[model samples]
Target: MNPSAWPAPAAAVANTLLVNPTIASRASARFPLALLNLAAALDRNGASRIIDGNLDRGFIDTALDALAQTRFDALGISVMGGPQVAPAIALSRAVRERFPQLPIVWGGYFPTLYPDTALNADYVDYAIRGQGERTLPELIAALRGEGPPPAQIQGLSWKLDGAPVHNPDRDFSSDDAPPLLPYAKLGDPRRYLAPTFLGRRTAVHQAALGCRFRCTFCGVAAMFGGATALPAAQRLARELGYLKHGLGADSVQFFDHNFFDREADMIPLLEVMARLELPWWCYARADALLNLSPATWTLVRKSRLRMAYIGAESPNGAMLKEIRKGTRPDQTLEVAELCRRHGVIPELSFMVAPPHDTEAATEQTFEFIREIKRINPQSEIIVYIYTPLPEASRHRKDRGKRAAAPLLDLRGEPVVFPDTPEQWTQQRWVDYACHADAPWLSDDLRRRIRDFVTVLRCRYPTVQDLRSPRWAKRGLSAMAAWRYRLRRYDRPWELDLADRLVRLRRPQASGL
Candidate 1:
């Protein structure tokens, strides 16, 4: 038979609806750009009629009623980190109950890492591992009887005869060149808020794929085949332009794990961002921030790089080494000071209650928090219990598994760390409150600490001010004054006392 006589390809048969379950945050939520990008990818490949839903926005009943009304061909739910797993499961179960005939497919890092576990669920009919930009459309086509069978679809998992089967991973490096996100499917871009920049009209985008550095606790590098690559700077620029003009977005947060794996690539991308003049923030390693040059700083200023969230993990040098964080405490300090000098707010994220934490190490972390506050009073510090990601080999111990289980939903709960006393764990939690200062605490000190805060709040009155960051600091300083006056406390001593007073109620209030 002649090739020219072959049959024409079939069009996309089923309309799709993608769901991004709530990350359990009420104050703010990010746009489901990953699912949107998947929709756009499907659209480019002749698959249209895509819609989106957030569990946080509408009742599950309403969402199901809408899906019932539309009769979508398939349901795509995105589950990235462990924190999103429980919500995704709930959404999947609800969708299955409402639309039993409709195919339910799970995607994103969680499913990618645990395909078998995802497929084993009673509600999940399929799972798309790694990247879904290509696999999803093919799966939809297959479901519609247009494309290959499930066995032939790469990067997909399905159960057969009560056993889960995973096909080969997709080579999706090219998929990093993101298509225009179908924000229209989401409706009312204004409703999507980014609170980091004071609730600006914001969207999330990715400039690079994968990370060059392989931190032992992370699985990104392994997931992407240890390849760190960048999309064309001009291409990224065009996508951002479309997001701005087409979707009314004024700010973007790069979802890249490490936006600057290569300095050369980053410089060109920063140059393009400078031309666009959109304020942005990204996650980067401490080393990357410390190495920024004067020219790069100028470009950063022009780009309005308002913040950098550095993955400092821990302030103790040994803990940093244990996690293979590839940077020292001094480098973290340097990066924090550097970002401050360049007028970019440095938000450092640390992990407490790691697998090997010692009481002494926890003490170093408490002191480290103070050093960061002193270096930049306006700096934002985020703390997490070291979560052993599902696929990582380093966190294979019994304790690691226990620690990882509770954090699967990204909720702030007390976690177990090996060889540490409960008092130390309690102390770490109190210090992580981000108050001006708190000393090491125990159960007996609770009442005294509360009384101290009550008295200080009465005198300082300004402690409740929220007009601006400066005002908050002024209020905090006034509260610190009490510790200085009565106890003859110096700066560090006053900060320690303030920390104790402000955070005393947390440990008892937030149960272990």
Candidate 2:
């Protein structure tokens, strides 16, 4: 139920049950969707179908095996692209190798940005380039019983007897429809999490979709063409009623690009969520809702709004401008202060070292995280390494200019992007370093990174998890930059980084 975008497709789906790759070597897989959304989309009109299996590593092979021999009608692959491209393309290849007639479809953040490249994969029968919330069902109908053979559908690219075909973009069909999933459904907690804990139940919810802000890192704006918020009560009633009456979900996690982008609508929504009594967390830019009122906080507390992840993106002022993060360090602190005052936990989504990050900037961000971590045990420090986001940045435009794309190994490879060969080796080192679990520190500049994290944990009692910072939250570029640099040394800089990173090796702490 992305507030801004249309709900999941209205067309009776072709029995397609979208599934995340089940723990494909840990990182290859994605977490589950809000059960409500999945249930809503699991419809029967064109054909009952699911949209997420392509991303699941465990069942992908099985799904493909079924696709090859089974009499299935439609196929969809959703990948965020970049490193995910290899698996996505490989899966499509697997599908083609197994079943030649099963009309395939591709969607997700990647295809939306590079429709042509997605078409390049011979295995892809059809590439869904935009919001498939509405388009997928329609495209399935156009294909299931045979209407258009991939040539006429909008927002798609497909093959016509081995040749690529492109189509004009179409507006989302479910633009005005209700959410595909009923919020009152409350989602099956087990289905969303491997463990029934306070953390795992906190799966993502797109009460609204798209973003009003044009932060360069987010794919929502580029993929969805910017902000679109569903009416507040219209959307709130679903989850509010559910949490209060249907299921007692204490915490809610938001997947929206910016929860506060539509403050006017949010205020009323908060009122409803508060009345319902739930806890929730969502991503936000610094003070995006600067005028957030106490009622907002009370409702937030009532609705289980305990945490908010804030993105500083860069500690360096200039980089923030270059990337258009739309917020600064001062504003970021403001956000933390506001959350603290309101008794909401705050996590810093920080960039350690990215394309524009410097050792100095990294130091500052580390200190910032430590400072916040000192204040709240619930405070989590997210560290990210930058990587090319096909749709998020100018990645697609830059891809062709890059020397070459690396080949993928399906048997199994680490589930991530390695911008360079050195990166591959470095990640290996860090992986091993984590196993070593030493308290050692380096005399070099990276020593500060080690020092900062060690101190931050002590300062913040609520910071229960003592491990490597969360990766995706840190900014992918940041992770890569520091990982590449830190791992470059012949010797392990410090055992703590690896020790800290042990958490990453755990089930994806990134999302549900």
RMSD of each: 9.1, 9.9
lDDT value, residue 217 of candidate 1: 61
lDDT per residue (tens digit) for residues 1-53 in model 2 = 22112122333335553434222333222234422343354353533334344
Residue range with the least summed lDDT across 10 consecutive positions in model 2 = 432-441
Writing each residue's lDDT as its tens digit, candidate 1 over 64-158 gives: 76575554567788875434555666677777765666678888776665676677778888988777888898898887788899899988989
Q: Which stretches of candidate 2 lie over 4 Å from their true place?
A: 1-17, 23-31, 34-44, 51-58, 64-70, 82-90, 144-149, 159-166, 172-189, 193-203, 231-234, 240-248, 367-378, 388-512
RMSD of 2: 9.9
At residue 484, candidate 1 shows an lDDT of 33
Query: For model 1, what is the error of residue 505's alpha carbon versus the real structure, in angstroms, after optimal superposition?
Result: 17
